[model samples]
Target: MKTGTNNKFWKYAKIITFLLTAFVVILSGCVDEEQNETESGNTTNNSQEITGTTNNQGTTGGDYIYGTAKVKSIQIVTLESFPVQVQVIAKGYLPDGCTKIDEIKNEGEGNAFNITISTKRPKGAFCTQVITNFTETIPLEVRGLKAGNYTVNVNGVNGSFELPVDNVPEETPGSMSTKQQIITEADNGTSISIENESTFYLKLKENPTTGYSWELNLSQGLNNISGEYCPPEQPEGIKQPLVGAEGVHLWEIKAVSKGNQQVMGIYKRPWEKVTGKEENFILNVEIV
Candidate 1:
C-alpha cells in the first residue's frame, strides 16, 4: 500500500505509453505502403523500356514524326552524236502513307523506269575507238511505306549512293510504243504505178529538179523497180538536166513480197550529153 504501489505504476505507465504510440502509427503506414510500391515498380519499369526498343513504334525515338515525304531527281539526255556522254540518275522515294498522291516520274511502259543508250554505230557517227560498253537499269516504286527504314539518294557521274527502302508495291501503269505503220500513196501520173504485196517502199518524186531523195526497200521478189530522176526547178543559168538525170523524180523500192504486182518505168532524154548524162528506163514485172 505504498500508495497502492503508486497507482499501479501510473496505470502500467499509461499502458506502455499507449502501446508505443500505436507502434509508431503502424510503422508510418508500413513505410508509406513500401514507398508507394517502390514508386509503382519504377513507373512500371520505365514504361517497359519505352515500349521495348523504338524506331517509329513507341511513338518515335530518332525524332519520330510520321507522314509526308518526297525525294525526286532524274536526268537522261542522249541525242546520239557520239562523243559519248551518257548520264542517267533517277531516284524517287515517297513514304508518309501516300495519300491523295499527285506526282512521280519515269514510268513509260512495261517494267517501267528506263534508261537506254544503244550503239550498233550511228547516232552522230564518230568512233575511232570509244565504245565504253554501257548498260543501266533502275526500276522502283514507293507509296506509303509504314514498316520501317527508308533512305535513298542516287547521284550520277559516279558519285552518290545511299539506298535502303523496303516494301512498297501497288502502282501499275507502264507499256507504250506501237503506232508506226503509215502507208500513204497518191499519184496523178504522166507515168506512175505501184502495186504492193508489202515488203516496204516509200517513194515521192515531184520532178522539176532534184528536191527530194529517200529510198528504202530491202528486197524479196516480183516487179521491183529501182529509181532516180530530177530536173527543172530553176537555180541559176537554167539549162539543167543532170542530177541523176531530170526533174521531179523520187523513188523508193524494196522487194521481197510476192503475190501480184507490176512495175513499169520510162523517162527519156540522155543517150548522149556527157559530163553527167540523163535519161531513164525500167520495166520489170512479175504477176503470178
Candidate 2:
C-alpha cells in the first residue's frame, strides 16, 4: 500500500509541473505580442500628442508643437475700441505626400491670440513625393478692446503690435475694376498709362527694422500714391517678415494728369546718400 501510494504521489506531482510550464509559455507569448502591438501603434501616440499640443496654441499651456509648420506674416486690421481685428497669414512648403491642410485652430483674447494649422495626406492616397507651397490667412478678433499693445501667436510664432486710436483707410484690394492699374517692380523698364487714375506699386526686398526702406522721390510728372493707403501698411506679396528679415517694400503713387512722367527711388537708409543710384530705379509712366 505504501509503494502504490508513493507512485500515485509522484505521478500527480509531474502532471502539476507540466501544466505549470505550459501556462508560463502561453503567458509569455501573450505578453510579447502585446509589447509588439504597442510598438507598432506609436504613430497613434504621436498624433494624439500633436492634437493636445495644437489645443494649447492660443492658450498658455499645452503640448509644444513639433513639425515644419510656421507663420509667415501678421497684420493689424483694427487696433481701435469697437473690437480689435487682426489678420494672420501663414505658408508652408509641404512634402509631396501632403496635399491639403488637415486642421486649423485659433484661440486667445484681446491681449493674446494663438493660431495653429496642420496638413495631411489624403486617405487611400497615391501621391508623388514632391515639394509644394501653400498660403493661408487667419483672421482673429478681440471684442471691446481699445488701442494698446497686443500679442499674436501663429502656430509657434509670436509677435507684438500696437492698436492705435487713429483711423486710417486701407488700400483697395488688388483692382482690375476701375481705370486704375497696379504695377510692380517687374514693370521697371516698361511704360504705363493713366487715363482716369492709376495706382502704381513698386516692390523690392527690404528690411525696415534696419532703418533701410524705399522712399519715392517724386520727379515732377509722377506724384506719390500716399493718401491714407493701407493704414497698417503691409508688403503686397511678402508674408510675415521678421523685424530684420527681408521683405517686399511696396511704394505706391497715384498718377492723375496727362503726358509722360517717371517714378524713381532708391533703397537705402533714409539718412544716407545714393551715389550711383545702384539700388535705385527709374520707371517710365504716361498719364492722359
Instruction: Give the top-scoring candidate (lDDT).
Output: 2
| lDDT of the candidates, in the order given | 0.38, 0.63
Give the per-residue lDDT digits (tens) of candidate 2, residues 1-288. 999999999999999999999999999999999998998789789999999996556444422333545445554443221223456657656766546666877887757887777765544446788877777767765444566777877766777777675223334664333433445454667776665366655555566777877766765766665532122344678665446544555556766766788877677887887777557766777777
Candidate 1's error at 32, in angstroms?
A: 4.5
Clashes of each: 23, 4
Clashing pairs in 2: 72-240, 73-240, 96-130, 225-253
**Minimal lDDT window, size 10, model 1:** 77-86
Candidate 1 residue-wise lDDT, 1-288, digit = tens:
899999999999999999999999999999999999999999999988876855236334323223322324543322111111223434344322312123223332322233222112222323455222212334334233333332333321222222233224334444221321112123212222233343323233334333433323222454335455534444567574655432344444444454433344333333423333333233333322
Q: What lDDT score goes with residue 232 in model 2?
A: 30
Error of 1 at 278 (Å): 46
